[model samples]
Target: MKMGWRELIRMKQRFTLMAIVTTLIVLLILMISGLADGLAYDNGAVVRNLPVEHVALSQDAEGQLTRSFLEQTDQPAGTEALGVQSMVLEKQNGTKDDVTVFASPVDTVYGPKELATLKPGQVLVDTQYAKQSGTAVGDTITDFRTKATFEIVGTVSDGRYSHAPVLWTTLETWKAWQDKMKTNYVSAFISQDPIKTDLATYTQQQIVEQVPGYAAEQNSFQMMRIALVLIGSLILTAFFYILTMQKMKQLGILKAIGIRTRTIGQGLVLQVFLLTTVSFAISLLLIWTIGQLLPGDLPFRFEWTTSFGYGGLIVLTAMLGGLIPLRALKKLEPADAMGGMTG
Candidate 1:
């Protein structure tokens, strides 16, 4: 470890360049990770925040809540059918914004904290909508389609669907707004326990995929993230290999002077470990600072678990990169290596 530090200090310019490059790559990776998570949260926060473990959709709906038509008779015991529809909410100033309206039974317990029974003409809206539209509790919001107005009684976090903020209403009010009777139908059923009914059941992940454009967007972002990881690994490997080649003569001289090959290998691994650790720390700090400065509406989210997970991956890949050049060191003869002979 001392030798590794000495070597890095001796070749400060070269090692500094490598560290900067590694930091940039890691920063890009963290940013992309945040973006991916942000998009996922924006599109599926409502369903993800549900207390239910499984959602039962009509078999014929093909796993889509919007397409499902479930009635009270179809739901099992302890399950409440919910109605979901996308609509525009008009502000007093006539500014209309898209929102997903969710109508659940008054006693349903499948929403975020602070969620409770909704009375007629009263609604709970996502905090995002409140921030965007500058509406608060006691403010009235009108539906563009039915021209019905509801008082905003409270706010819920993580309440969004397909990138739209969600508004919670009573099942009776929702049916009335849609010009349907109470017995008409609901989109799906939410339950914490598993249901063995013939209807189609979907886990939270599956439900997220059912959101419009959610699957495709997430797939694209994930593929890009994977590509970035592969590219970063390759670059690190190549850099370390080149650095190793430059130090081969020194390594051979040390070996000739009784330094064990294992010791040399450990030194190289230590250098990579140090470089990756420092670079990852700096990158995370930069990300945190930038995240703090970013506006709330940018749809960017950062999680400590994700940062640690990616940092671990970077360290592992960088260490693996260092190990790739060890084969060359093992094959080198002290005489030939010192003499600068390739063979």
Candidate 2:
């Protein structure tokens, strides 16, 4: 609408190039952010859903639940061991299914359900698994460990962990199976200690940090996203700089004719803002679209907060990037106009 915007459109090729580059950079950042979100969900959502806020695993290892141990003597008075395991179950439908076996002393977690009669060979399976396996209550499932068979007593809703349907096993049954398997590991224990444990107790975030490659993988994504931000801003600055510098004569003429430096600065900044907005919009759309195309089990979780945060970062980077051009435009000399006029 103003002379500044009019001038920006005059260099169609340069403006188009800047917009295209920004679009690509923004798209890349959005995609990476989506993947990062997915990884975070995959890392700990189901475990995190368990009511307790802190976790206790073997001080000896991290990540693999099979490596943790909770001695009865060392169960940390107020702490609860959330015993979990992998077991193969044979359904009445005559299909073999792999399930994560969960054994807890009480239903303090997973929406809180206390089974009055938890004994050997009585178990529960998640609704998702039951749906997939087409099994109903009173259906007996054989445990591959010690070949200890279990009868499906109840259907826990939406209980899943590490891509497997969860099954409820009695703590006693779990102990017996652990003895049979020779692993004797009870995935991880939870503590409601206004206190710490004799073993290493990790806060929720600390536990997430221990997930294999989560930190490194996140760092890699962050670095790439940051670089994309910088590059987009730098490109905007360089293009505006070149255009403004080359048009020093024109600026001088406009200044001599009473044009304000502020007006010229607006032109450069608006151009940057316009291109950046378009790039960011394209990127946001691309991320959502691509995420939709991903398989359900691919572990991509695009929370609104994360998506909005990344988009805001992209916009801020684009805005900050134009500061250099603002300075360069501000310092322009009217004298350069005469030099151009003379040439």
Per-residue CA lDDT of candidate 2, range 53-144, in tens?
A: 67777778674554566665566666666676667777666677777777876444433374446567677777656766678888888776
**Alpha-carbon error at 111 in model 1, in Å?**
3.7
* Structural similarity to truth (TM-score) of each candidate: 0.88, 0.74
Q: Which parts of model 1 have CA positions greater than 4 angstroms off?
A: 112-118, 136-140, 149-153, 180-183, 339-343
- Model 1: number of clashes? 0
lDDT of 1 by residue, 170-241 (tens): 777777777632347789888888876888999877988889989899899989888888899899999999
Report backbone clashes per prediction. 0, 1
For model 2, the stretches where C-alpha displacement exceeds 4 angstroms are: 5-21, 62-64, 86-100, 109-119, 122-167, 182-188, 242-249, 278-295, 326-339
What lDDT score is found at residue 185 in candidate 1?
75
Q: Clashing pairs in model 2?
A: 38-301
lDDT of 1 at 164: 88
Pairs with steric clashes in candidate 1? none
